[model samples]
Target: MVPKQTAEIFQILSKGNFISSNGSQARLHDCISHDDNFRILKEYFAHIGYHLESGHNYYYFSQQDETNTNMEKKLEQFAHFIDVMDFFSCLDVKPVTGTRYRVTQIAEECFANERLRQKIFALSRKDKLIDKVIEVAGSLANGGFFEQEDEDTYKVMDAIHYLETIISLITIDDDGEQKNS
Candidate 1:
């Protein structure tokens, strides 16, 4: 029989969100990771055209065929993620799984560091430093790479590996060209 949480899994993954092992929905993650569940869910989702794909301690859905519009939108979204990851990579506290970050603290860091301030300014049009930080953090949170614990604190989720993996796969050519495989 299919897992009891099949509907719950479908609800989240179908919306393009991940069930990350370190996020609030970790129970759902555990459900998917259990023996036979992945195979079962993969078959179930496949019948409906979604391919249930697993990443490092996380699960999401992918479509076998995507329209050009969807592909373009995803490329745009990934480009935004590149900038967001760049900002996070420069932080004193890296964006590893389970790492918690506070907006005010990050804003203070940006206030003290001209480089960080410039990076965040490029990412957000918000007038306030704190708002700019919030925009970046909120983007990640909305994308399932981070989960907001409270009003000000957000914790990185295991799904962040998806971003890291994609970013790491990118390479700069000898002619200063960027390429992704």
Candidate 2:
């Protein structure tokens, strides 16, 4: 039999969301991370087409038979995430797990740095600096890489390692070619 929280786990991971060990859903993370739960959940989900996958302190679902359209859409979404990651990487506070960020604080930084301001402008079309920050941060939050602690503050989630892993796997050739290793 599956764990009691199986429904709750499915509710989140089925939608492509993650349960991060440090996020508000940490309890769910614990439920899934319990003894043998990973193997149990993986086998259970495999019967239903979703392959339960684990990452650095986080869990999500994947499908083996994704269509071409879905693959294309995912590639496009990953491209946007690359830009979003680039934007966050330039900040004084890196997006390590459990790191907290304030929109107003980031906006202030952008206001003080022309390079950051330009990067924000490139990422978002919002007229206000704060809104641009919000848009960028919201993208991460929506993707399950960050969790909003409050209206203005967001905390980085361990699921961010998913992005970091993917980015790290990519290699650039001497002639400017991008290769996946």
Candidate 3:
């Protein structure tokens, strides 16, 4: 019954592996974000040993478990994801969430602007501006922080909740080195 009701929506979300409010795909995007439908679907997903979590206009899963062997590995992945998230968070306009971004566009901007160039330089040892920008953006995309829109275009997506959760964890982390001299 649950699967039937949400067959189309689930097919798209589960396959593309994204149910993005910040996506350019109109039908799938609107289906998940719609209030009444979201409420019903959220309840249905909870029955499958995963709780649905909301983050800034996005949704994701929170597995319910007592003993998971991969917890530490997951934590390490999240740490890396958090660093990548911070990089995106620093961008002005939040990279215009869900919008397509081109490596050349950013590289061109960096070449024309001192601040952007500095930011690119800060990201890598790669001398070429385009390569440096793509390296940073690609890492985030690999981590599910962004989705490839096409051969050269990428779009931020709802799965960014993974990064948001990591950022929240770091925000309250007390295990930092003391700076006192």
Q: Per-model C-alpha lDDT, please?
A: 0.92, 0.92, 0.64
Supply the TM-score for candidate 1.
0.94
- Kindly report which residue pairs in candidate 2 clash with one another: none
TM-scores for all predictions? 0.94, 0.94, 0.63
Error of 1 at 19 (Å): 0.6
What's every prediction's RMSD, in angstroms? 2.8, 2.8, 4.9
Residue-pair clashes per candidate, as listed? 0, 0, 0
Candidate 1 per-residue C-alpha lDDT over 155-174 given as tens digits, one digit per residue, 9 for 90 to 100: 99999999988888987567
- What TM-score does candidate 2 get on C-alpha atoms? 0.94
The digit string of per-residue lDDT tens for model 3 on 17-135 reads 55566664546556666667677787887776556556666655566575565788777766656555545555553654565678787777667777666666876778787778778
Q: What would you estimate as the lDDT of candidate 2?
A: 0.92
Q: What is the lDDT of residue 52 in candidate 3?
A: 57
Ranking by TM-score: 2, 1, 3
Encode model 2's per-residue lDDT on 18-132: one tens digit a residue. 9999999999999888999889999999998999999989999988776889989999999999888988888999989999999999999999999988889999999899999
